[model samples]
Target chain A: MAYMKDDQRKKLAVDVTRNSKGATKYILITISVLFVFFMLILPLFSVIVNSLKEGLGFYLEAISTEYVLAALGVTILATVITVIVNTFFGIVASWALTKFTFKGKQFIATLIDIPFSISPVIAGLAYIMTFGRSGWAKPVVDWINDMLGTDIKIVFAIPGVVLATIFVTFPFISRELIPVLNAQGTDEEEAAALMGAKGWTIFKRITFPHIKWALVYGVILCTARALGEFGAVNALSKTRGETFTLPLEIDALYLAGSADSITASFAVSSILVIIAVIVLILRNIFEHKSKANREV
Target chain B: MAKARKFRGGRVIPGFGLTFGITIAMLSILILIPLASVLFQSFRLSPSEFWGIISMPNVKHAFATSIGCAFIAAVINSIFGIMLAWVLVRYEFPCKRIMDGVIELPFCLPTAVAGITLSKMYSTKGEIGGPLFDWFGLRISYTHVGLVIALIFIGIPFVVRAIQPVLEKLDSQYEEAAYILGASRRKTFFKVIIPELRPALLTGFGLAFARGIGEYGSVIYISGNNEKEHTQVVSYIIMQKLNYLEYESATAIALIMLIISFILLLFINIIQIRQSRRTNNI
Candidate 1:
């Protein structure tokens, strides 16, 4: 206690009053850390704790083995299909928007933001109302079922999940790519064409490289989003034993009131967090590289 | 710039043809079609009935709760975002990089995870929510308060990211000039610094507001939706309709929100444009 001299105490009081940047900075940093602790770190604590108990063995013994795996498979399948679909759509849309202008160019740019504004639950319901049991696509689905005889379904199944995820995630690739492409310009494309390099050749040699890193970053984000997709998937699919993603699995486990079953959900989330961290690090690298390039 | 290479009809550029054609098709199918479908479905009800459906106390409550909570959250963000950004820009501090990363958490963490985590923290037995409730009997879980906190969590980053760039872009000369004239730091900030930031601040506020209006996942767990009372939000109302097989009602609700969002965004744009013009005149 004596180590805190009267002079030192007076200096501390003076520092607080005059607003020493260091002391205030410490308070600000602490507040920020508290924010992160509340927001990012805490939720992760629960997930990590749960995941610890969920060995690959817990999954095998607890439930219907085939059903669980199929659910797992369906989740991956949906993520893959959605990523491919959205990436292609986003790329083409961005590429097209950059390379051309027409009567409604501004209108179309606004339209591209539709997915961002849309709630996933609404998006899911949109698909269902359009193509679910009492939908416009019902007859088409029925005809296919009749032709194929009973083993096929679209709504409330993997196909529906894929389509819904694709719809909800469309803006990712286009939003990232359009800006990069717009900045890149059409000079090279024109130059390549003048040299008779052809459309595909021009894209491969020039356009692709310019946008490749951003494309990867965007696609990774899109994929992570797809993996953790919940609201839309929840709306579309029922019968958790039949169709469930990792988040849905967690939802079901929580609702079923088994603390132990929650383990599977946590394990899946931990896996996703790991994947996301890797993707985010890559994104950060590309972003910093682009900034550096701009400075140059 | 060549008229010959412009590919006819006074088009801006040659590739415009292909781009326009593709963009229009994509927009029509993917964007316009779904939104239009929502409107078309909403029209399934008669005029008076549509009003009744939309103006139900439950629906109105949901709508109001969502708007009110979101507004509160956005206001908090506006204040905090500005302060946090100022701190980040103006000072050198320990673990400053970590502070930078923390702002982006609302962006990176999955919304579902956010919902679950926040609900646990604010429940009757958890850390902060529990302590506050124990002290004052002011519960956060399953209440309007919980809804706002959830929203504030998700909406903070939108404003912070938006304003951080603008703050960095401003010239510090005005602040110095004000200081030389003997203005207080507070007066200098309000006079010199804030006027420059108004347009950017408003734009960030608009984005955060728009984002809050559409937020669903984080709100749902904490909101404790009873359908007829305080907790239900517009997005959940849409979900409930989908659950009830009332497709028209669902679409109507979503369409209404979409229109409101459009108007808010348009208003923000107009203000920004006029402000920019005024500043240029100055």
Candidate 2:
């Protein structure tokens, strides 16, 4: 058989009908572009413009209030704790699921996916059922409170906020890592093991480098979810300004029914929108890198 | 014990037990305990009590509103999402990357933020819905239509993400062949392309449906939370129940929502499994 060169093969594979550029193609493309513009771009543009429409001074004033500042702090704190805890779990869970072929592996994988399916509001309710003042473990909590002679509020406090955020965002990092790790397999790690490298050493020298980009991508996703979490946070938050995260504050302000409060809500929303834009950009970069890696 | 031991495949890397232990421990503590508590609390109620909670008119209506609206939104999303994915994949356009990035804005943006944004836009005196209301007497804010719009906003990304890769990797030769064989473009698209994209479409539909059903943050603001009608959804009802210290009732509703969502996810999983099987066969 005669061999075809690369350029010839590529040219032959190109479909004449597809490149002929018919009217249907143009019509469909126009409809799609228009849909995306009206549905997505327009609303986003409205938010950004309205947010700054009150001018820079009003925007800054709205975001710089004590409650808003506190909400910002709580949001950052939650994101940090969520990222740290989920990263560890993501690494271990992905390693166990992919590197080891244990019984109930499929079950555990399904279990990890529970958070994604359940409502975040319901998740907050579950936490309250466990740790609220009238929760099942109330007696235990009271015992600890009496023992320590200290008042620690779990349900309506920072702890509850952190827990709900963790529950909602738990699957992001692990979900991202598992496919990448499974695709990578354990050949290199096993090879390193055979060469007498310790477990940590092998992980550091081998697995870390391969999955680092994925890890960053997962962490970024986890951070975004943590920052944006609302339903669970809302259910658990007393909204007393002390326990309010940024989303909670935004909701509170929006519902406050004042001209100033409405503008303030827009300002806070603009902050979240800014964070979202950053996440979107980072995701694009990582997605491109991962696609390149896969092609290679 | 021997059968269980046999399931562990041969791997020379160390820390299997350590990783396994951490995984199980964290999973149990962080996920299982909280999830199980909902079931446990629901079980604490008598069967009749459970029935009473779930069968109440309000409860029934909330469920109907959420599931019904989400279904409608998912259908709309499937259509527009396919179109969006096709445009992004097939055409060479300016700001394509920007368009792709913005599609994911909902996934990262706080739903509360989205809720306010939508409510503001669609409010009776607002920019978009103001003219909408004045010209047509369309009261979108605090209406079922608003709720569906919010659901669609959050749901669009799922369908787009799900279908984009499938369209990108789709070979054009098959379409060309169909055309050459005297099949019209419409026929080729409906016959050939639709079948190829069906699984992804279904999976995306289910995902968007599940997400819409479980959604609370965005819908709460615009849903009006009206006790007069069925504007309230199951998640909002659950929050209301909790607010009144009705733990058992909240758990009961949550358990039901969880069960429905689980079935939806299971359906998606089955689709994915079959998809992988088909790919493996190919």
Candidate 3:
């Protein structure tokens, strides 16, 4: 009778602990979900809501304005060019870093990550000092313009916008590619070389297949970053309607301080929000694909 | 001959010369040379001149506001980030995948968009701000409180992403052992689990802190940008200097920021390397 009573007591203790554990889990989940909602989801929701508050026609008209269109064009142009340049750099840098045994390799890798730590505003300022009038490179820039018989302004121009974008997005592709390539090793390439296969052939057949998904993943991230680049581009691009990217245009419209312009700012913001959502979805898909490839 | 041997050490694959040349050339033109200009520009000023610019009261106040707020934001992020990572890793909730995916929103979403939306939502007549003002009479937008909130938003992903993988790979055996040894649940979490998570947590805190210090776009809108001592951040000061065409002063401030960030990153890198080494040894 006493033994039975002790067993019952132990059973009750276990049940109590388990119930408390369950409560703790529920509480954690609730708090975490609420945090995400308030900090992230709700603000995104408000953007869309306020955007259409003046109705869809106004939203459409707001986004289709002449400056908005020009900003959109500039943004897309910068993103495309940045993507192309960074992709080429990514492939080469990752290949060199991973496939070869070289001194200062780690140093070089650290150097690539410099842009991530540096403020984008500083990045813009750096370019201005590098190429602006009275800069060290001014004579070189001027000579290039004179030799080509053309006016080519770098700072406060489209070239400056593209350069700033490139600076900020420099490491995304290579950072993604390096690890994937490192894990792949160079055994297959070595074997192919012994069999007298050319370098291009080896890469196309062996290495390319391994890194293709990661490359695309990197490119997507770079494109998203380039599209949204604000600070660096803000520093370099001066003429508002002529050189403004989407983010800058949104800033201008918001600061214009008219109620109509504020509403228009939200409308412009919705376009970026939509692009960001699409980028998020694509990022999720590619992230899974890359992880699955690594496991395979 | 020594160089040749070094090159031959891992030369099984071809195209080393071509690829390496391309890497160096592009890196110089794209990154290194441009950044060097900042250093060179700062050097144009005498040491006293550089000190005069950065040591101004307004400049010092901006740095203090930036660093102080970033530190607070990093602490908040560390606590909540660990919680979020824990919940995502250990719990099986509905829409969990979507929830996990949404954590990266701050990363991909344009900061200017985040800035405008956050500013609108936190303004006096805004949805969240309106309710709080009606009840507690608290104001958020254009205050120091609003600036920290913006920094927190910019920093959320860094901490969460850092902790997630570490939490995922943590072995359960240690926790089980702690429990068997009569340690309570909370005891096990703090003693056994937290020590294991320390490196990742520190890494996340460092990264978020660094990012918050230099944040510009998201902060400029919400921070009101009017109150110099209370709201102006370091990056805004750099912009202000540039607007005045004071390139030397701008570069001086930027160089300092660059140095601070590099140190933070270097510290994080060391922690990561040590963690990896320990994991490999195990």
Between 2 and 3, whose lDDT is larger? Answer: 3
- What local lDDT score does residue A59 receive in model 1, on the 0 to 100 scale? 46
Candidate 3 CAPRI level: medium
DockQ of each: 0.31, 0.61, 0.55
Model 3 C-alpha lDDT per residue in residues A1-296, reported as the tens digit of each score: 24445446444434433555587888898999999999999998999998998998999999999999999999999999999999999999999999877788877887888888778999999899999986788899899989999899899999999999999999999999998998887777878987999889988999998998898889888888899999999999878779999999999999999888999999999999998899889998998899888878
Clashing pairs in 1: A100-B16
Give the C-alpha lDDT of model 3. 0.89
Which regions in candidate 2 have their CA more than 4 angstroms from the true location? A1-17, A145-150, B1-10, B171-173
lDDT measured at residue A272 in model 3 versus the true structure, 0 to 100 = 93
C-alpha lDDT (0 to 100) for residue B218 of candidate 3: 93
Each candidate: chain B TM-score: 0.90, 0.95, 0.94
Q: TM-score (0 to 1) for chain A, all models?
A: 0.82, 0.92, 0.92
Clashing pairs in 2: none
Tens-place lDDT per residue, model 1, A48-81, is 6556666657744544455456677887888898
Score residue B229 of candidate 3 by CA lDDT: 44
| Per-residue lDDT over B4-68 for candidate 1, one digit per residue giving the tens place of the 0 to 100 score | 55565553323545655665676676556656666666677788878878898888988888888
> A207, model 1: CA deviation in Å?
2.9
lDDT of 2 by residue, A69-156 (tens): 9999999998899999999999988888887666788778878888887899988998898887657777887889999998878898
